[model samples]
Target: MLLAVGLAVGLALLLWARRRCPRGAGSWGLVLRHWLARRWLARAAGWQRRRLEQACKDGPRSQELLLLEGAGTPAPDAATFRERHPLTRHSADGTEPPPSPRPPLGLWALLRSCCAASSPLQGSVLYLDVLARAYPEALSPRGTARFSWARGCSLPAAAWPLPSLYCAPEAVGAAPSRAAALYVQLLLALQERALRVLEAGLLSELYDALATLRASWEGLAQDLASGGLSPHLELPQGLRHQLEGLLAPDAARAAELRAECARGWDVIARRLWPRLQVVVVAEPGSEQLYWEALQESACQGLPLYSPFYSAAGVLLGLNLWPEQPEPHYLLCPGWAFCEFLPVEPPGAEGPPDTVPLADVREGQEYELVLTAQAGLSRCRVGEVLTVAGFHYRCPLVGPVRRLSQTLSVRGEGVPEDRFYRSLRRAVAMWPGARLVDYVCAESSLMGASSGACAPHYQVFVELQGVRDLSEAQRYKLDQCLQEDFPVYKSFRLKGSIGPLRLHLVAAGAFRELRDAVGTRGPMARVLRDHRPLHFIQSRVLS
Candidate 1:
């Protein structure tokens, strides 16, 4: 009897030690482990709800916490990544994917949790979306929510089960999954290593096309100043197609155009164009323009998204965009996910000093760490977000930039979000001009002394419709950039850095970037999705 009892105890310890008997552990390990992880996750959720309830127990208003669990996701501990990088150089055949995010082989199950009953992690659907793509065949949604969860699953390479907001469709490839995956890998490498091709100039034909486009824009900008704006101008068939592709990124013919870019200037002149779409040409206030565009664009289908927006909707009340009034964005509640925090000294780890979420001051930045009912004790997601405001005593925050996106060429470190905002404001100074694509790299400026070169930021911009502007017009933006971000601008003012030069390129520069660094999202993705502006292109803009 004792011998039998000892065997039972040994089995129990083994199951616990093998992370609840995860896949490859034994027969039925995947299914049984997943079940155990789910059970633990439920228990953690209850504990978290209790903690929130306890925190609000003495308040005048009761703290209302909404718990949203994505159907059939592994417990938070089931699967996790140490870091999330942008692009990679992978084989075009799609036979392999960096081995880390390998296509799902078995079920996802949270084997353990560092904070099982300590705190509740919000955004279960967020992780579930990821898992679905990782293991499409295994991790199917148990129930349907009002919104579509796995909308990106239809795409070739970016088939991961992530939400539509988290990915940009322009980067994904078009057909046969492997090729698409390869395209994504190329695009990622291009974006990640943009500096490699910084010195290469635009081919002669490409240069002429840009010059012609600028000439046309010069005429248009002059007309706009004199109050003559056309609703939409007729374009030559070829020019029209290229302009359309640039504006609607996903519309471009991926394979043919990418091959042509390598061929020569003649191919670019034949395949691409000079002109661009005039999105908004007003001095200020583009409300009218946006409304008109929205009216013209049809709502063809209902958008399926993950629970991030749903959770946000729950945290605050659902606020719809004026243009798309049908669907709302929400956050998925429960389960800890990880992101990195930009600490003051930078890159040091171990429990970032965070004020209680209740005590967090608005506009102040803090490292975000989340505890889950899964494997992670506390995970870092490598993002810097700001507390915008409060949502019923909870802080409302939004991501600002990634941890690695800081550029400090002259000891003046400027974050990508900050830089992107300044450039945007600079573009906004002109009416009807569009800032198509941009890349900023550390370039050596002619030094203060002869025979010396100083490192400065060289901002390469591809503006399709905006031509040359007067000193006065450009001067208007200088003040806005300085007043707004001031760090890089201050370096410029102090002569510590050279004037931030903007180099304009022909259309399809960013398209080249998209083709080079393959995107991790679905093809035909939402056009306005967040794109990392730092080094997402490989071709030089001149």
Candidate 2:
């Protein structure tokens, strides 16, 4: 009798809770899974913090003492570890580290945090769909989510209703068009409530998506009103079927988009996804140019959020407060033993001294170093980061650039940031022009075909709102470069360097090049050796 009564009461409570829950919000099992995942993450983070503290405490001891004396193992410390293990750059160190054992919870936490927003429940279009399954409320009809890459993602059945598109790796080329179609389809199906654009390619890809939307809005509006997929979008059969189902005849929404489309490209994102709250991007780095372009164009009025920073199988840091404008990452305490080597002058010899994370000062730039258990010794990731400020005890780092990608034609050795600034200034001088994508190559790579007698820089740019450039307009970039570097100016004046060559390509040239090259990473803005034939052949403006 007692058992029967308990079962009856539990069943009644469960049914009542189900009735009260929002439609598609998920069952009690999902709530339990979310709770477990969150708990595991907290524990993993706590373990790492404790390990870091212990390493510091035991760091002063001799290596001999640490190895021989079981009772006196030295505490892990960055400075002492640096003294023993020399720094290794990834390019120079070609061998992989032996698999190092990881605490189960720590490994799980690292995997869970990949492309995850600092707060998953509320971040639309920036949150990963796999995690969204653990909390169905994140996939509720009120909002949507986006992935940085769907290549490795295994989207469970639960994410289907989230109103976001996940293209299989095979369909990467058609993604922009498919994404545009899905955006319009959702806009029609959900009406005004479909005001979220979920995407995760950082700002550059987002800019491309907006451009595609502008090009296809009229055709998409027609498709939505007719309850069918746009013929131009080459999508998988299954995905096409799923998308077609949402294309119910929504004439009113179609008309709404058509009217908004007339307002211009600058107003497209805002007019379409007016309720979009936050923009999530990939690991923050030298993306300020892309961010500014986005701000001036489609992503106007949207708050930006960068949740956590990780790369090449390492969990680097987390942004505890993404509400702030400038993206800052708080270094993970337990992931790896951390150190920062101060950035030296261009010709500085040997490795400079390294400082522990605690010693990093505000505004100082440093290259990150890590000593971890994986047969990995002290490895310099070659990524330079600036200490932006701090969140409590941890340093808040903003990425500057990769050490290897700097341009060095005529030994000017201009860093990525400087070149980006010069290009940005040149773009600003041109009226009605917006930069889409650009790549720089030394004239030596292209030889005489570059149209320069001496060594120079061959720049290819894709621009919007500009067709042909007068010689004077193209010369502005050379002038800006000289202002940034006296060395380049001297070489040009001495006839040792040829005039900078600029080529304008068709709008989608770089996008096609990216697909052709394979998306292991974004096309290098500066190419050191070979120039892709796709880029050379696609030049439209003489």
Candidate 3:
């Protein structure tokens, strides 16, 4: 019994050691270290290594030195390396001898050597070549060609042929025997190192390139400002001419140069900048110039980076553009409006007492209230003002009192109160039938003969039912909708609303609410008012 217990304890200890050292004892680690050192030592003396050093001195070239070194030539240079190994390289006759196999080296060691090498460019090129060889089938023809070129080989226009040489210990040909074995080993080592260097170097280069491009752009912007390029793009021709004259020495007679710069900027902006969409928020009936500029920017692929409307754009361009909105706050001068009291005049001492009419106050806290006329019939102009301790006009709308309108299905004017009331009534009729969501799709009719308004609205409704309803029941529901909803009736009579449709949601449509709030209750309790519920409701209902 004691002997059995001893055996069990010994087994347990062995298992624990194995778990702690997955490579099996320190022996494997030591072997790997030894192999790495041997490979590096071999590489240092290899022809490929010599060639790589030569290429580094020569500056950037198409040949991949690292690949040549990894392929087997001692200190191999990119210029001498071919696409295929000697064994793989074949003459038209297909009588080439099999290439000698080289021992595999760990990736980590190879990378470390390449990165630590003397030449950054050569190191990068060599590393990329090795990576391609290690995963030969994974790369594309273009990728393979690129790898070869970077290594220093000027490939012939024809398709790559098998290598004519081979490393063999017992061969009866003109091929060198001992040299072949050495070459194969050297090649493998070089390839391993090249891969690591490529990975690290590529990332570094990408970041550096981006930074340089951004700096260039900023410098150009400064030059343009001094040269008199107005930020507003509304500068007079005389001023612009003077600015052009000032920039004549550098930019004159070089329209194409400016265009080239713009193209370069566009390329970086499109390929590297984070978010590209630019959104312009303006009052209804506002000019379209802003939208045009935004569209132009998008076409150039340097999309307008606006946060208010381009949330997806922001997320997609997270790497390149500022994720937040540009001009995060707006400033409006107080003289522009009479709705709010002007605490102080322009250039007044101390912080403007009240607030300048048109000046924007960043980080200022204010309450937003939607006030209606006495009868709650119409939203009065200047009614939606901000209130800190005192009332202030919102900078977003300027001083203009813009009235908001709701469109009926038939393009008739529908009061906001009536629309909300109809929705409330619908919910009341069937306690189980809840009016969950809504949206208005805009349309327009052109030409005077059309007798239609410039803009039209189509309503979409989301309804929740206790149980599933048949098509016939849905028709009845539509009728109920028309009768109870004034907007629906007006739309039907005017042919503004194409048709009435019911979007029925599943019984568990409120599941999302449960998931979000970690509990179940009235959805209204979870989602704040004014949030777009159409999308969420549609998913639940469907």
Candidate 4:
């Protein structure tokens, strides 16, 4: 049959391709697939850029054509399109409102197309040896061909396809004991696999995962010796049996791991997996506090790498990590049209001064503006970035902070950088303390919960050591704040602003609070409202 002939030809071609690769080079199929994917991605990126540019040019005319191409009436031209649909804010409406203008391209459609162009080769190429060991069959031509059609799930573009244990935050929050049991299972499996690198959505998740391991190791060892999951875990029947298999009664190994854990979790990764190379996280510059905590907590001399930079569902830049002390995002070509707006003063408002991506200069800070086919003419994502240098024509940028993260009380307007610097200095002064995570809120929203009469700043911090601070330790933060900002100091002197109240929460309390509110994604450092602050108020250390 024709099908049989086709299969034979394909097999012959694959074998010939394998022979072409150098001797002892495992398999040529992976290389072929990778190179093909790379080519496909390049083509897709070019097409997407062209489509986005055409959509921007056509403007409202594009939408009219899409909706009424076969209708008798002709679509509006570019001039008519601009005259009829002037650029306006979402809130711009009269008593008798006109229909809101819709983007020529659908946001979700554009996002899907953008995601299609995402190449995972960068993140996975470094782990090819590990992957080959983990999945030899997948490296073969036949297996690769079969897997292309096998459907069940899809991975994020940057994620490596490897054995992973997934735990939903909601599930963990709902059943802590069950989650601990699952973590024990994961650890045992990881011990068998010798997992050397860990990757997660954010650095905080990585820290939380290890913290769970630290808390559950004793129970994990006991379960391993007994060759059973804990009875108290109350896991589902199918999962319980599966987990029991991982606990294969390795008493000596269990004891060794338990002993290593008992020594301390400071170098746990090194002790457990001596080859631990790096911990990779996705969010880089925005989550510096979590990054610091993760570094201290990981403690295996593990370097962290963030492979890509994304904002508001758009991929903007890719990191050239390890080359710089702090990773700078090199703007991704053909992904989206990027612009930078000079960051205006907090209250100063009018049309922003925006510079095209090509004109950006080094060491200057600007608010990032992106134009994509993402259901808007243009979107200023509130991300502030400083251009580090250039990679040819593309500017390398690092995140400063978000414009929305700026905090103001009585028009004092404290910028995020100043607050971060003050907090860093203050934390250094606190004896035996290191900041795990922190959030800030203006006292105006807190009402009596702030325990202050005048407007002030409320800083809630979770610390690794030092359960409670002395009066002097608590005052250090306020002192740092005043030293950093003269306007805040003036307000404090005039009694217009009260002292900054520092609240300490238990180590994992903030994670719990965020999960409880179903905010598993990145949350703003400065909360606009009091609800989340009030939610965590009960858990604050007295």
Give per-model TM-scores: 0.41, 0.73, 0.21, 0.69
The candidates, ranked best first by lDDT, are: 2, 4, 1, 3
- Which candidate ranks first by TM-score, i.e. highest? 2
Query: In model 2, which regions exceed 4 Å deviation?
Result: 1-84, 92-142, 147-197, 226-228, 238-252, 346-350, 372-376, 518-520, 529-533
TM-score for candidate 4, residues paired by index: 0.69
Q: Report the error of model 2 at residue 70, Å.
A: 17
lDDT of 2 by residue, 81-143 (tens): 456666676652212222122222233444454223221211221223323332333333324
- In model 4, the worst 10-residue window by lDDT is 143-152
Ten contiguous residues minimizing lDDT sum, candidate 1: 193-202
The worst-scoring run of ten residues by lDDT in candidate 3 lies at 309-318
How far is each candidate from the true structure, as Cα RMSD in Å? 19.0, 7.1, 32.2, 9.3
Alpha-carbon lDDT, every model: 0.35, 0.58, 0.30, 0.57
Residue 174 of model 2, lDDT score: 37
Model 2 pairs in collision: 48-334, 55-76, 58-75, 125-145, 125-146, 125-198
